[model samples]
Target: MTAASTGDLLTTPDDLFWQEHSESITESDEELLRIVGSADLPALLAALAAATADTSFLSGDLRPPLTPVDTVGHPHGGMTPLQQERGRKVAFAALKRLRDEGITRARMLSEAETDTILEYLGNGHTEWAGMLRHELDLAPDKNGAPDWRFEDVAAGRDFTALIVGSGVAGLAAAHRFRQAGVPFAIIEATDRLGGTWQKNRYPGVRLDTPTFGYTYSFAQRTDWPQQFAEGHEIREYLETVAERSGVASLIEYGSALISAEWDGDAGAWSVTTETAAGTRQVRQFNAVITATGQLDIPNIPDFPGQASFTGTAVHSQEWDERTDWQGKRVAVIGTGASAYQIVPAICAGVERMVVFQRSAPWMLPAPAYHKPMTEVFSWLSRKVPHYAQWYRLWVTVLGIPGRFHTVRAEKDWPGAPLSVSPRNQQVRDELTRILGEQFSGHPELLKHAVPDYPPGAKRMLRDNGVWAKALTSKNVTLETSPIREITPTGIVTADGTHHEVDVIVYATGFRPSEYLEGIEIKGKEGIEIHDAWDGDARAYNGVTVPGFPNFFMVYGPNVGGVVAGSLHFMLERAGEYALKAIREVLERGIKAVDVRPEALDRFVEWVDTENRQMAWGQPYVRTWYQNSRGRVSQIWPFTNVEYWEATESLDPEDYDFLA
Candidate 1:
């Protein structure tokens, strides 16, 4: 049940570390930092291996400190000219200490030493060391993957699990289970993995999170061309992970879970799956993990006379590549993330772009949003393993709540309805200033562009001035009017103006509030999962629920967060918790582990309280974070580390073990 520790993975073979990277650094970094290699860097790096043998090379004020709230993952810290030098200094120091007394081995960083390094990486957060050390797995050898794997002889055959959906969550579950040497099968309803990435094929579709932080902790790709990786690249990345990690072989492609019914006597669930070929198969599993994300279902509004509009109507999820966009007048509905990306992409090609805006999304200033990864940085990542992880840690600060202080609320603040706190107001002003600057040339469009809502009130879209440029174009019209109804030729606004368009692009987002929509889950006494909760979705630690023994869910209700980067971390945490719980069941020879109703209620109550203090929790704000019941079902009201700690252990008191 327990594995022995692997010692000091941070150390390297003394001379080889210096020999290989020194050559690479000299050759590659000339384009970016010329002051280094031709004169100072190569010499310093060549001598680094011998100099670092003292083990005291890690002691500092030795290198430059990291810039606070770094968006890009620079070597040591910020992207400023001075910070680059700081990064260079830090990189040199780490490489210097690769050997101790010319020996192949070195002492592991003391807790204090690790904490000092982690503090710099975590944007100076006091308590981030313990979490980041494990979560980020910054060390070269450590993957920080869940190790609560069952390796007993009966693990694969007798103790088995069923994972539905081959999305990132299912992939995480399958990968961890594979590591545990457990028998498992993933049933993906679709032919492909990557979930949203596979589905959304629209042009300009790319991840908002920086690729450094967006990638999986275990599988870090060093040579990404863009800071924000595009959709196809991400999909391919997931495909690679599935194949390379040996998870693809266990997947039943085109097989979708139809119903999972629990049997008390058998201590297993009778699961039914319908394949794309229209064949149905029944199987039994000790545990069922639903990795079908909440975002699986798309939300398309039913406007009056929508079907009669005659034009080609397409949701962002259902994008058609064959549709000729050349010289077409496209009407894009909903000014959210998809809309923001889509409008700029097709604006130049279209005769005219009519963007229908319901609410203006606050644009976060991201200058390098579309910037490509420089040759120097990409080369450095390939040469140095820790450099990539360090960079990941740097940009990863944006995705943690404490590091991103814009979401924290103050009680009875002066900002009130517009902004949550003084800090929140400050952020709003900065965002507003950026918006004003972007729209300075097109002052008329300013009225429709600037967000009236507080920062963190809804989803914040990334901007690099393209949105304003697209909107202000002669061929584009920014319409703030509420859509009245669809007509045979075009759309009619509430102002009674009929605008003609050749195509309709519904950029409306997914229905995240609706959890596990298609799948039928019948638990104890034939209680359906949906009917049991009525309209509300609640899960204990966003994993298990009462009466639904042996069932686990990723992307469960109230587990989503404002600062969840790529959502891979949260999924991993939730998946790890479920796997550990299953391990306990199989080890103890129990039927299944079900969360206690009291525990579920208590967790939900706490979540509800915390959500009330968040910007999305404000009664005035209407965001995708809320369900039909007006509850903030999407956001976990805590730091990423808090969720990690909570899910780190399987608390027996919180669950009921069925015999």
Candidate 2:
């Protein structure tokens, strides 16, 4: 079918993004061999079945064969050359059928049929299949705004919301609120739209998640230069979202949320914000959603004589573009995600680079981490109905099946502590194989690089072979020795070795437990939110908090699903739940809606118990996932689907409403 035959149901391939990445197209117009070669053949068949109302593929040779669960790809994705060619011709015929029938949208599958299809998609894994069924409705064209709106319940109520921090979550919050007809204002501390993407501009910085699934489902983009987009590209995408969604006009840049005082008398939050020019303003907001992300604050270790350093010192979050590393010795203080990206990016130019490691982070092998999207896939995404959704569904399935289960500690296991379960041991073995293969010649480096703890203990960094190559370079040294102090010239190890360097890049991660760090919030009982938590952050579904009426947070406490699941998807859920709660107050004409302390307690109890079963919560492994109390305060120790289900609706019984 020509592009016009499908009509506006599919976006025309004339977008600005399409034009920019046009050079990356490898396949000709008539060729779909590339598509079929890499296709999740079952999903392709399902898509065709839904589009053409043909289920014969399910009973025929194109049926999904049960295979061992693979976390990275479809279980039955692999096909022979002959099979792929035949699938390609079948797919070509299916496109023609779409034109012949003038089909716009594909029909949804029956629940029982969907279950069977889901099991097929997941290689007979039944447990996670139930969670993915709801998401089947959440495609680009289908799931945009909520069907319910504020106007439907509170027609004339002048309810306005204040969204603090114009970041990824904030942008999505603004988009959702706008779509629901809620008048809102987005306050940004910086002059720009993208929050972390704008701030963290270190070399080799890109999204660890796949670009297709990482994007907002409502405003989906078919054209991304790389499978995992770079920082600047992500920043540009956010800015584009603001402009295209018309939320740019509602943003007040250079304004930071300082404090929010809940006024019991006024029945609203008396919010305070400070601008860049030292001007502060206090305004009343019906609802205040703090979208200040988890990784905003830079955590620089207070090593001895850090001020005595003679060279340039900067945190990865506070990266200064003017500082040059070319031909100069550099010291990367911590081996985290930023360090993983920065070391390889700058090591080649540096005269000598020393990477100080508290511990080694597990790296997932991602060969296509640096590769761009192929033209054929892009064509399929645009021309084929529900292709992008199916692709995302497949990616989500691949991530879920064995992943969440393997991370949890199996009871009474008879294996090493290096892995949580037998399945986990298998995962650990594969990862170890990757590391051993990369560091084969360098035994000393391999020993230091290999993580003693199990995989998924800490967040895994996406590897493109650059980290291995950079570490093996003659100039790069992985220092496992304890750092004693910092002198006027450089850092000193406990072994009496003073390693001098020209620059000190602190890749020391963020204070994720310190939620809403700069913001001082006082709730109904005149209690500070920070003092309430006392450094251990906990929230109901990572959104609402007890005693804090009409307050919500995005990317908040214990929402850390570091193993699997997409962060953007979590952000969407959190936003939706928070909006739903806000709608309850405005619609019901209630003064406020505050989460019961018992609800928060139950959530914390569940999370803590589940965390005890996960790798991150182990006493042997310690990372930013825990706080000073040694509690897993950052990660929401549950399946991402569970969080999605919990936030699907706002329960009235969970909260107290003040009419």
Q: Give the TM-score (vs. native) of candidate 1.
A: 0.88
Which runs of model 1 end up more than 4 angstroms from their true locations? 1-116, 123-126, 136-157, 401-404, 564-566
Positional deviation of residue 71's Cα in model 2 after best superposition, in angstroms = 6.6
Predicted structure 2: lDDT: 0.77
lDDT (Cα, 0-100) at 30 in candidate 1? 32
Model 1: per-residue Cα lDDT over 1-659, one tens digit each: 00111234443321111122322333333343442332222212212322232223333333324433312223333345554455456544444333211222223444554555555444466575545655444233233454555666345547668998888888878887787777788888888787778889998999876787777666666567888888888898888888888888888889989999999899889999998888999999989999988776989998998989888889998898997778998999989999989999889999988999998888776888899986656554554334444456545554564324566678887787888887788887787777788889778888778788788889877889999999889999989889989999899999999999989999999999889888899999989999987878899989998999999998899887664444777887788788888888877778989899999999999989988888888887888899889999888888777886788788989988899
Give the top-scoring candidate (TM-score): 2
Per-residue alpha-carbon lDDT of candidate 2 for residues 1-659, written as tens digits (9 for 90 to 100):
44323322323321212211112223443555556556556567656665565555454354444333423543356544555567667776776566455554644455555665666566565775545654564222233356678778889887788999888999988888988888888999999888899999998899888887677655566567889999998998988988888888889999988999998878888999999999999999988999999898999888989898889999998999888889999999898899998999999999999999988888877888889887656666665666666676666665553366767887766664688888878888888888899999999999888888888888888887888899999999989888999998999998888999999999999988888887899998899999998988889999999999999998998886776676777887888888888878877888889999899899889989989998777777777889989999888766666876788788888999987
Error of 1 at 77 (Å): 5.4
Maximum-lDDT candidate: 2
RMSD of 2: 4.1
